[model samples]
Target chain A: MWSTIGEAGEFGLIARVTAQFPGTGDVILGPGDDAAIVTAPDNRVVATMDLLVEDRHFRRAWSSPEDVGRKAVAQNFADIAAMGARPTALLVGFAAPPDLPLSWADGLTEGLRAECARAGGAVVGGDTVAAETITVAITALGDLGGRPPVRRDGARPGDLIAVTGPLGLSGAGYALLEAGVLGPDDARRLVGDSAGGADPGWAACLREHRRPGPPYAEGPRAVRLGARAMLDVSDGLVQDLGHIARASGVAVDLDSAALVPDPALVEAAALLEQLGAARRAPVEHMLFGGEDHALAAAFPPGTDLPPQWRRIGTAAAPGPEGAVVTVDGAPARAGGWDHFG
Target chain B: MWSTIGEAGEFGLIARVTAQFPGTGDVILGPGDDAAIVTAPDNRVVATMDLLVEDRHFRRAWSSPEDVGRKAVAQNFADIAAMGARPTALLVGFAAPPDLPLSWADGLTEGLRAECARAGGAVVGGDTVAAETITVAITALGDLGGRPPVRRDGARPGDLIAVTGPLGLSGAGYALLEAGVLGPDDARRLVGDSAGGADPGWAACLREHRRPGPPYAEGPRAVRLGARAMLDVSDGLVQDLGHIARASGVAVDLDSAALVPDPALVEAAALLEQLGAARRAPVEHMLFGGEDHALAAAFPPGTDLPPQWRRIGTAAAPGPEGAVVTVDGAPARAGGWDHFG
Candidate 1:
């Protein structure tokens, strides 16, 4: 099923995909119009966007069409939830070679549909184009129901830090697939078991990597409970917490011993290393590798951790003026990924 | 001037360009957030999108970076207005080569700024990445103030067709440019004048091709004045009107003699052919050429033309089976750009 870039062209593909999704009343006008008309419950709309280019963001070899589609939607939905907003609608712009199979295209749409259904959002509209490689640009819109947006710049000294999901699973999964140690069937089986929670803790981590389960309800919950500040851990825990610390003019200290997901990852680490498959930096990888898509927040002391959240650290007044994030009392070196660098 | 794509990585470039724009109040969230938060009046947001690739949409040799940027914004904005909506915000995704110049990037941003200012919208967010060539995907959001979207399917039989601005000048200007008949100064001078006017209209046509005046306000005006069906004339009048005929289940009869912009296009057409240019097909050119960005609508007969509109044709009930568009009582040929055959 090889297809060239010129066959389908952009507009034809868009019309085809747009026809598949049934419209809700909120979408007064869908894909064919100049713009889609979506009614918000009140007057506030939360909009977030992400772009994924072939080879750079995902390789066709590692991810199936369905996985790529699901990952794109899941990551974006995480951003909205991190804002304490409910996902509402999505507008996608896809660029692919004209010769790509209609089945591949259809599979991508189905992937989006599955994820949107999980998050309670709808794919309202999108644009498609003929290009040399595949690219997906997604803009996710959400509603806050009129709540003040929880910002990263509001954490204060004496606030407790917490996270709502596991970490380092995606990076680990990528490592396994890249090393040829895991075939598609094996990868799927592992990921599925993790999702189905046969090994509750590691399953949580694997699921965290493949398709993140954003703490959707926890966003507003944090806002209602007076969270001092917040952000999603797309870029590993220490690096992301550093963002809050720097933004708030404070210092963050994480007690890694208390992180329950760490031990589960240790087992995978040992297994891989025993097979001579582990990279040199296992702990560093878990601490700095990103795409976890978990929520991290700072709250006043004594505030109860929501049912989904786990206390990870504490925010303290600026330590030596410039220090931001410290693990085990020392400023951790090597922040997260820098696309420009 | 040349900047490697790696040097101007995605986030860095987005940060740089975003810093150049002024923020509006309704923008609750700006570039750095997961997505922007915009105030959607009437609780509904209107969104339209357009994709322009390097060779297909614009040739680097034919148009400046500024011109390309302007065209991108103009086309997308026209779609917003065709929906009878007021423009609000834009989200852009840009993919370009690593070796492209920083100056070219900056110039393109300037063009986007200029068009956004003209349309009364702001560039709210965007994504940037490396690609074999430049590709821009823009999503424009608009507000309709609770008005029903004027759709192409709404035109009833017996409606009079009207146009809000001049047409066919863009094709004429393109033909002139291709022939190299005019010097740079004269060509620049003829950029924005209309064809039927005393001026050469080359400048107007050229401007129309590069950055069209969409008559954004007229969309709402037409809807308010009882327009049954409306669309912007990206393709030429004869062809675009045919779209309405097909979509609305009616036949359109256009009075060719009444096309006021025809005379203004003659001198340029003659000059090109005289300069050893091949004899171009006039109807073929006018019927299929696009990018004018003029607004077209259908209204009941005797209905007052909105102040911005001029009478062009009339619609008749569908004849036995297939709807048709006739120019001077003859069947009009199907003419317009099609991405896929």
Candidate 2:
């Protein structure tokens, strides 16, 4: 095997990168063709795309290739799931430097394969090109199972808002990494035998940040349970909820107690505090942090919810203040992740 | 309006860029949500993705933002077309530096809109992020209209190889730009009016390079006409034909006469020669140059071809040489576009 992609060459590297990728199941035509065909059993395709740029979305110094690969797929699948669909296939567009290690590509492929397997999908096709930096672009396709898509504009006044998974864990993990409390893969590189012992909470936070596992099935389950509005909490719960508010022409209010920080995030907050780094309350991360990839939805009042989905907020008729997110019936600081900003 | 993306911010920029984009066609759910749903109609989705990186795939100094946008969509659409499918939706992932002008993004959006209109599709949804360089990733979803996908592994012995449109003009145009002849927009900036007078042939070549108009309809037509195997003539006709040859277990031999250079390419070749650049014949460009994105396919011998398709070669049962592309019954040079190589 060649050490570098430049050495392996395009065709050779492509063959190597895609050799053992699973092709059975939903894929009618996989890689090595002009295009890939995936079954759209409902005669509709729920598709979403995401881009992971090195240094912007991820840093190689912090994340392993596998982690980035998993993240790329996870982000896109979250979008598909948010639409109440089950993912079927992913088409990747990878651009990396020629001198990039072939091993990294292999690890990335493994991560993509593992994630696709986890989501009941396959990596059907991809294009590879040489560039100065690594850019992973993924397109995830899903099927809605003959149901009307749950759109963001469906949230009605008096609907209860619930989250399908933990919120702000990735952001907390990111805060830890930014302050040198690295993830398991590079924890030693950042802090050589840090002053504290190994912490499972910290590890969990790191894992969540590096390889988030969105509740893919819960999306369809929520739809079947008659949830109205749903979205992936990528740009913070407060900010993303604002999207539902605006789209549905309603005002959203979060219950402070329901938005309590997780134990892992509390520990992450404590670590940052001890490090004398910039600090914020654990709930602040939940409020304004991003990249959690958790699904948040608005369900009709009196709807029975699964134990896994935590009721966090409620939608109400918009007041004179128009559509926005508030806490405890009061306006909360409005902030969200914006790449350009 | 804000001048730079950084000034406009993510929300403002997204609103501005996507405000005027058309969305009433095959898209079931367009932007303003986590995912876009496109109608598949026949329970199958023909999907393809492609990436364009600044400086590698295009030069801003040569290609306008509009040109890059057109190229990005064209490449992915060609893949869908090659699969005998009609594109329905496109999801874009755009990453650029904060310093980029908002007007550039506007121009890019216009180009995306124009091309999507041409292909009978809509720009459904996209993810925008900040990066050090510009990268545009596009995923095109297509409907097959209840037809079986035309694959690259179906060419039988004695099948005639044909091309759906002109080839090598993009490569020739690339040669012109690389040698300072430049496209219409950048030509004045590069050559300083020293090239005697404006040339229509060179302009056509530049258009091919900057904004290749792949005869998309021809792809589904080929499939309907009973094409045995087909592929997009990206990375050169010879190199791409090898895909079908290898996949179908056939040797492909080109009719040198049938592979005549287009007049536009001949002019480009002459210009490149006069500039003392690395010289290549127009036929050489036809044989080895790439990025034309025209469709190439194998059909049963004596199958009547439409006027648009030119019979270029023949597929035969593999000899000792295994699967390969030969010219004039002799082994031809096997050079083509390779990103790493």
Candidate 3:
């Protein structure tokens, strides 16, 4: 086949791409219309966007087109959950090389649909273009159910800092993969398995890295429980905690003694440490390596931390007027991942 | 400075990147928060997206980062406008090489902000990442004010076809630019000087290319006048007309002689043609060269075309039933731009 955009044509291309997606009822109008219509519950929508470029966000060596699609959907959905809203719909724009397999494109859409299905949402509309590499831009829309959005600035003095999901596994997994220590089975286990048992700690960590299982159900629950401030930890724990502290004009101190890796995770790290190649401090890794997609929040003093969440620290008024994050009574270093430095 | 992502940690990078952008009203919460809060007016938000990748959508030689940003914002906003909606905000995701200058990134944002201002919208949120090449994803939100959305499926047989803006200057300009025939002054005249044009037609056509001035005010008017089967002419006239025909299940025949090109455009194209150079067909070029952000719609017989729109054809039942897009009793060909073969 000749490589020319003239062959598929704009409308034909749109039709072909859109045909790959199944309809979700949230879409009042799907891809065919001039503009897709979506129902906005509460007459309001929370919107966010993320773009993942080929080889920048993920490598073909590490992820299939399906995994890329899943990651894109999961990350955006996590943003919505972080806002105490349930994701309802997504609009994705994809740019890919002309020579790229149509199957790969279809797989990406399938992965997006699958992830959205898991989150109770659907694809509404999108645009596609011929490009040098794949670029995915996803706009996630969520419904707040009339609840005032929980913000990062509401933490108060004496508030307990907690997280609903395990942390530090994604970074460790990536490190291991990059270091080439893991074989096919081990790599698959590290990247795909989410159960808490294969070294419950390591499994949890690795899964956290792959597709963060944001505690979507817990966001509204935390809000209803009068959570003073909250945010899903997309970045590392200590760093995100620092965000809460700065925004709330407070200080946070973590009790490292109370922090312990799950035995399985410990064993995995110990093995790596035994190999004399581990750059990760198990506790430090969990605290500072982000992408866990965990829910971290501030609750008023004495409020019980739910079964899914673990209390890690307490907030106090900014000491000497500046916020601080102290680990084990000392100044904690290393905040988390930044997109630009 | 460190050469790779390995230097400044991802978390630190994000902090430094986002630190420069101060919070605005729509951002009730800012970047450091788990998620930012944005108010949706009337509980409705119109959203659309587009992705542009280097070499595919642009070349470093042809466009500056700022130009890319403006064009990205402009095209996405035009889609919202086609829906008879007012743009409210935008979210942009960018991926580029870490070695790329911060000045270029900042310049791109400046361009985005500037273009959004033209449409009464603001950039609300975004994500940035390191990549092999620059890729931009822009998502635009709009408000429809409770009106029934103007759609592309409403045109009926016997309706008159009209366009709100000029056609084909972008393709013409691009042809010249790609041929290396444009002097600096000619280039500016083609892609710059968006406003204050004494030549409305040339200005309209060039504006259609660089930053399409979608008929913002005319959208609501068209909806109110019972305009049916509306769309933006992203592809050339004949091609887009075909879409109207297919979607409305009707045929459209144009009177080519009725098209009056602006004198300046005619002069320019004539000069190129006389030199046996330009491969672009002046008339055929307008018929198929796209990127003109003009509005097209079908109206009931005898209905007055709006002040800004020009009546171009009439809708009839599809087929020798009528030529789907006949120009002077002949079948039209080469309708418009195609994305993929």
On TM-score, the leading prediction is 2
TM-scores vs. true structure, each candidate: 0.89, 0.95, 0.88
lDDT of each: 0.73, 0.86, 0.70
lDDT tens per residue, model 2, A60-126: 8788989988888899999999999998999888899999988998889889988887888888888
Tens digits of lDDT, candidate 1, A40-150:
776877777777888877777766777778888888888888877888888988877667787788778888888887888777777776667788888888788878888
Q: Candidate 1, residues B18-60: lDDT per residue as tens digits?
A: 9877777667677776567787876887776667778767777
TM-score of chain B of 2: 0.95
TM-score of the A chain in model 3:
0.87
Candidate 3 or 2, higher TM-score: 2
Superposed model 3: Cα runs more than 4 Å off: A1-17, A181-205, B1-32, B184-208, B279-281, B321-323
Candidate 3: lDDT of A176? 55
Ranking by lDDT: 2, 1, 3
Docking class of 2: high
| lDDT winner between candidates 1 and 2 | 2
The candidate, 2 or 3, that scores higher on lDDT is 2
Model 2: colliding residue pairs: none
Off by over 4 Å in 2: A183-196, B183-196
- Cand. 1 TM to true fold: 0.89
Model 3 TM-score relative to the real fold: 0.88
